[model samples]
Target: MSNSPAQDTLAQDFVAFAVESRVLRFGEFKTKAGRLSPYFFNAGLFDDGAKLGRLAEFYARRLVASGLQFDMLFGPAYKGITLAAAVSIELARLGQNKPFAYNRKEAKDHGEGGTLVGAPVQGRVLIIDDVISAGTSVRESIEMIKAAGATPCGVTIALDRQEKATVTTATGPQEAAESAVQQVQGQYGLPVVAIATLADLMGFLDVQSDAALVSARPAVQAYRQRYGV
Candidate 1:
């Protein structure tokens, strides 16, 4: 479904915020998958309290706008922990208080812990993260939720790259690949919501009068044309 006018504005505003925060950068950068990308978004840059708080606001807004209902939020190890905590706080501020949880990378052998922490995993749970380059994190989270007898209803992320995903087949590998977001939805039958996308970033760049941004637009567009879903 298409976003409403208000949602579109918020998405654009997020792109602006990302640029100002230097979280979204335009340049030549190699991805984990070994592809050189024109632009890169590093959620790890939102490290300070103020930056994290503002980032959470964008996530909360997108989640509410998505109309996806869930009983709780689950963040994976590391980055997911911060994202889940911050988003829960923001959601509460937006009048939707929900429990949040996270897991340790290794199972803790002491204290009140096994692997999971925070609220008990129950009902429909939403997994929050910075991005989904591969489906591995999401798969791990799904297993954890099922192990706890909780249902994983959806996933929320800061941005969607919308690039083609490579997959193994019986013969060799599938040349026709789906995007990471598409793979998650197809495999799990759950919605993946993002505050912004590559398309939105390109749109933002398109309207800018800055010489650098204007010059960088074609590179990003070319990358999208080659790999976008």
Candidate 2:
């Protein structure tokens, strides 16, 4: 889908906010896949009330603007729990009230006696998450939603790394030559909407005069050229 000027501006603004909030940092950092990345984005760092509030606002705005249809929100266990709730509140504040639900990593033996929590998982559910590195969380969320009889319709994340994903096939592991977001969209037939992507980050840095950002551009660009989708 083509991004409107407003969407482009939001992407730029989100990149700026992430840097200012220190959620997106420039430095040598190792990913779970052991790739040395020039930059790191830790959504967990948006821990405080204020930062989370703003983060939710960004998610809400992006989802609303994307025009993805959904009847409810579903957050996976752990980080997604907070993300789903916060984004739901923010969406309601923006005049869209939707039911939100999440699952527990381990099902309870008492009380609710199940994994599902919050509002019942229902209708076309949109999954809210920080990022989709390996697509593990997304898979789990999809399963949970399906088990609850809800359709997994869309996913909204803070950023899209836009790097190729490795998948294990009958022949063995091989690069998918597509980003995790792309794979999710293809495999599940669902749209993955991200607030920004590696390309957007590059664009954000392009117009910046900050010496640090300018200096880091080369490394980020090289990394993208080598691993980007």
Candidate 3:
């Protein structure tokens, strides 16, 4: 596919519609780190088939636009599994002819048993997911991908919070997570890419001109101040 108009449209929607729509509740949320966060972009809220389908289309568009050339798309178990199925279908719809696979949390004992389900993975693999918080899952995924005998080419996700610090340290969990991304890329030669960053979501909130958004502007700004790398 030669990156045509339709491709461009989908890429745009990936950032504006799919990614942005997911940023909900720009309010005080006690995060996993025990920090009071002003906003959250929970991909888990897309709890229906239609929303997931749209999300997949955008993900496929982003993968194409970002020039992530992969023979197989690997989604981690559970959430990744659903995302993988939807994205594979969207990619097919977009004429990408891509195959996708995901793993089980535990390997099945009977039938065609394996940790991984769906198509066989081969060549450079792209690991897809909703977000990257601490990157514990990402590292685990790398190991799993390697065990499956496919080289990880890249990692793609919907949103990048860009708040690379999550604790009181000079560098916190978010920093550590970003450091992990760089380290993975540097050590393993794999690139971790995202559709939109924290700034994009903040911008989207600002443009709405709503009071909730207006108030959130400051908290998000403070978040960037405190956590930004």
Candidate 4:
């Protein structure tokens, strides 16, 4: 869970911003994996112009700091569309301009007449997204990038839950040894970077004085101990 000093600072700051923006909430929330999580992070809640722009800056900063060389960016459908556009803008503002593209959920019948929009998929492409749970979006994106003959260099996400990935079998759900992010890295042999993680959230709680925020730490810790990777 250790990060470089720059990454540590950014993760802390991003966690604070997320809390203030109400994108991250501490409570009993149901996860897609059917677990009751102590906290929830909704990237879609970063809806306003200022908030979205700041979120993009965090992404750009993390990607740039990671030293991952990417020719362009590719965003999967839905959530990623906005992230890719805004991050591309912020990276350009930071003087590392790069072409970015996104896929539509369905193919367009007319006009450009394809699933992909913006610049053509080419070269080493970085996939931007909010987080990896099941990693369905990342899988789809990798297929698209490879279909276009582009190498999927890496993936940059806003947060890493750092919990075990799950699978369904005859007995029901079972936890995997690797988290979703770890699975992606192993399966594709590509690096995965995150701006913040569950560890960073716990770290934030450890240093905070607010009783309300600090009180949630026990539940979060319990959850991590039980299910975190």
By lDDT, who's the top model here?
Answer: 4
Q: Report the lDDT of model 1 for residue 91.
A: 97
User: Candidate 2: where is the Cα deviation over 4 Å?
Assistant: 169-173
TM-scores, in order shown? 0.96, 0.97, 0.84, 0.98
- Candidate 4 per-residue lDDT, tens place, 90-115, comes to 99999999999999989999998989
Model 4 lDDT on a 0 to 1 scale: 0.94
* lDDT of each residue in 89-204, candidate 3, tens digit only: 99889898888888889989999897888788777888888886667667888888889888888888777666553424756533344433455566667777666666666656
Poorest 10 consecutive residues of model 1 by lDDT? 167-176
Candidates 3 and 4 compared by lDDT, better number = 4
lDDT of 2: 0.92
Best of the candidates, TM-score: 4
Question: Between prediction 1 and prediction 3, which has the larger lDDT?
Answer: 1
- Residues 44-125, candidate 2, lDDT per residue (tens digit)? 9999999999999999999999998899999898999999999999999999999999988888999978989999888899
| Residue pairs of candidate 3 with colliding backbone atoms | 164-175
Q: Please, what are the lDDT tens digits per residue for candidate 1 over residues 46-93?
A: 989999999999999998998999999999998999999999999999
The pairs that clash in candidate 1 are none
Off by over 4 Å in 3: 1-23, 165-184
